[model samples]
Target: MTVPERPVRVLVCDDQALVRAGYATIFAGYGFDVVGEAPDGTAAVRLARELQPDVVVMDVHMPGIDGIEATRLLAGPDAATPAKVLVVTTFHTDENVYEALRAGASGFLLKDATPDQLVEGVRTVAAGESLISPSVTRQLIGRYATRLRPSAPAPADDGPLAVLTPREREALTLIARGLSNAEIAAELVVSRETVKTYVSRILTKLDLRDRVQAVVLAYRLGLVSADG
Candidate 1:
């Protein structure tokens, strides 16, 4: 419901021309500034650098470079000023979901999602929130993440999150379970602002980039399992 204060700058990338035009139009309709469009990851990366859009709508599979690689170039830890990337993937390439997340995607959007969902996906990531509003998509990220993660195990109780307070830890567990801040607020009988504070503190303590990273860390540490 809340749009960005200014026009959210966006870059749309897909190998298909029609898909590119359609998404650009949709984003433009919603008052987003479609700064540039790219047909492949190489162009996406280049245009993103040249344009400095607030968010990049990236397709997973492309002819050159690909979305995962582009995401890394744009949003990876080494990026001096990382751009927020919303990766668009499909069920068939579910494994790429984890790869994209690992490559520093700010969020995930399934290819099958409708136009409205697609728009919201960009908005969500641009607002610095993960696009896990699609609960099923969030669950799938956890499921695929479990499969793609390495065999090495981590301590369930005392890894990077050992520094968190008890309530913050509980909130993070709920986050890994795909609960939004609003949902977690209701669950904890606290206000949404309070939940936001808790999430901020948790991210600060763990030195994480965003909720997507937090979710991945949770799955890796076995704090929340794929089955759940």
Candidate 2:
């Protein structure tokens, strides 16, 4: 007999007890292992470090360190072994979303998200995928793209753009434009599998964690303009 795969380990962090309980129930119902819960950022960070969960469902406005700082501690560039963080907050402002991404969150979602959305968000992050909500993708990234800067200087000869071939660069641009793999395939007259391959290659060459990071890098490096 084949052994079943392990469930995704998740840590839920929120200030509201009711909210925490709701998420725990939902996660458990969906076969996710609800490993821990925290009412504040400090506790969240402590638990995350100790448990090393696959995904952390973080709240942005918690007391003490808050989700942004806690995310930084767990997933930021300085983190030794970064865990994927999915920020869930009632606030949908551009600043909050941008700050959370800068802190190394793999994705952002509104607390008002449906149960399906929430469950999928957790699973997506656990699977090493980014989960920026569609609404956030359309509004926040467009409004805040100008505020992002490349993490490192581009080299004169080729720079970060050099690592990607022309087709890969095109795929990255389409990703920045928020096109799904299918949409990209339609646009380029290529197979969906081809588009998927291009996306994977782009991520690998850039050393990016997911598509969300790729979007950020695209804007920061002027691969796609903020106006578009």
Candidate 3:
């Protein structure tokens, strides 16, 4: 018999009690475990370190450390055992979204997102996938690609890109352009399974955690242009 998966454990953090309650209710209804709740980033971090939830639904504007700093502490490069963070906020501007991503947020969602979207966002992050709203992908990453470049000069010779085959490069480009696996399959005239394999190989070769990191790397490495 096939084994069933465990319910995703989630921690909800928001200054508004109503918002936290609403998200907790939705997650519970979806069979997720609402492990804890926090009204501020400091508490959020403390609870996250304590509970070690699979996913953290974080808000950006909370007082006392705010979400960005909290995310960095919980999920950033220096984190001892990073938790996946899905940043939910009212703002959709490039700066806010980009900063959250830089702080190691696994995903970004708007507070106005539908219940279905919120549930899916939590599941996505918990499953080690990343979700950025399509609008944020287009508006923030596509429009502001140059801003994503690093201050240091890029290597002159073949670097990480050299590891990927041509087809993997093509797949990476489409992923950077915000195409889903199914969409990429259709675009490349291949089966979805084939696309999945390519994506898996790409991620392994590039040592990327998920599509979010891949998208950011593509931009930083100039694999995908800002215009298209």
Candidate 4:
């Protein structure tokens, strides 16, 4: 029999002791290792740089250096080996959420999210997947859709992504909109397995590793608008 892999290492950052303990408890139950905790962004950054954790649960607003800035320092384009940061915040305001994501957070979670939701968010981000609440993502897109600039034109339907079929293209659009596979199946009125197949075809045709890159490419190619 094969032995199980090691648990994902997580760093929790929050100003409140109780909040940190709460997350520690939840993560412990899910078989994750809570390797460190920091009460502010400055310390958080230090711990992250030292530990090189698999995931960092960041609180966007904190005293001294804020989480967004710290995230930029740790996970932004310049990092030597970036760690995924999951922004956990109480505020759902458009500016707060957008700023956190723009600062290079791989995912976002609400402070009031259920225990299972919190655990799943950590796991998903650790697995290189983005997990934004559909409701929150939709609201953000709607509010800031017009601010997005137009994408450069695709070359008369010829490019690296041309191998995808019409159905696969549809699936890609929905994926960029952050729809889950089950949701896509319902929207297309097709079986879940059918939707899965289409998604697989889209990924293979485009050579994308996961949905996050698909989302970025959709916006870049104008396949999915900011409003979407």
Candidate 5:
């Protein structure tokens, strides 16, 4: 069997010892290079700056600094190199999820995810794609809908995405709601294949790398408000 080359470097951060150990073992099994492990957000940030890992698997609720804040510091708008952050947390509706996303996290994953899912999440983020659990994404839209700040100015590239048709916008909103292609098709009365095509177009028009980036843009551009 051909072994997959080790190209992705990862930093694991969590307050609990077992969580870190579990992640280290799981990720290592997939041929990822576990560069370092941190027990809190403060250390996570410092280590990220020092190690320059390809991806940071951050926990939302750490003792000091917190994963959201650390993610912002490392991947936020002002970050120097901005390693990709993939939040792994236990609370599905934690307030930190939004903060992390706004802080430029590439994706979010629940701690209860299957081992296979965990491996996939790391690989997805390392490959420059975003992955958010469907359940959590829906919860995020509902929880933050009332708090969304649509008045925020759109980024420069935002206008270019206006090329999407009205239907496409609908698809985008549902995507932000964390609906899968089948779910979206059911809601829109379209075929699953159609939803897939729309998703592809949306990603292309917005120049997004994947669904995760699309979610970030949807929020930043006020297409899907926190209140929506």
Candidate 6:
């Protein structure tokens, strides 16, 4: 007989008690392990460090420490061992979204997303994928393009991007433009599996956690203007 698969452990962080309860119910209904819930970012960081859940569903505007700072503590470059963070945000919180992205968040799920979408977002980040929808991503990033780092690391011969093969680099550009694997396959006239392979290789070579960082790098390289 096969052993049962382990449930994905999730930590929900939001200021509102109702929101926290709602998320917990949705995740529990999906058979996910709702390990912990925090009413504020301060508690979020503390609980996450102790429980080490597989995914953290974070809110942007919590009391005490904001979600962006909490994310930085949990997943930032300085984090000794980063936890995957899925930031739930609205379009009005674009600045927080950008900051959270910079702080090493794995992906974004809109606040108004359906219960199914909520579970899917957590699952995506838990599986080491990012929630980068083409239209929404371009809109969010383009609005704050100036906040992006001005340096173009992709062009530098000795930079991290230089380590990728030509095809891998091409895939990275498409990914940056927010193309799904299927869309990328059509654009490049390759199989979807082939695009997936390229994406995996590109991330490995660049030492990136997911497609969000890849998109950021591609923008820095000027591969796509991509305003939403």
lDDT value, candidate 4, whole model: 0.80
Where's the lowest-lDDT run of ten residues in candidate 3?
A: 149-158
Residue 80, candidate 5: Cα error in Å is 1.3
Candidate 6, 117-208: lDDT as tens digits: 88888888998888843235565765455356475434534466778887887788778767778999999999998988998888888888
Per-residue accuracy of model 3 over 1-228 as CA lDDT, tens digit each:
999989999999999999999998999999999999999999999999999999999999999999999999998889998889999999888888878888889999998899999999998888777899755755476555568676763642257888888888888888998888889999899999898899889889988777788887887777776777
TM, every model = 0.89, 0.90, 0.91, 0.80, 0.72, 0.89
How big is the positional error of residue 54 in model 2, measured in Å on the Cα after superposition?
1.1
- Candidate 2 vs candidate 6: the lDDT winner is 2
Please list the C-alpha lDDT of all candidates, in the order they appear.
0.85, 0.88, 0.87, 0.80, 0.81, 0.83
Best model per TM-score: 3
lDDT of 1 by residue, 118-163 (tens): 8888888887878753634666777866775668766767778789
Residue-level lDDT of model 4, residues 155-174, one tens digit each, is 42557558877788888888
* Superposed Cα deviation of residue 190, candidate 3 (Å): 3.3
lDDT of 2 at 89: 93
Model 4 TM-score, all chains together? 0.80
**Per-model tally of clashing residue pairs:** 0, 0, 0, 0, 5, 1
How does candidate 5 fare on TM-score?
0.72
lDDT leader: 2
| Prediction 3 global C-alpha lDDT | 0.87
Q: Look at candidate 2 and give me any clashing residue pairs.
A: none
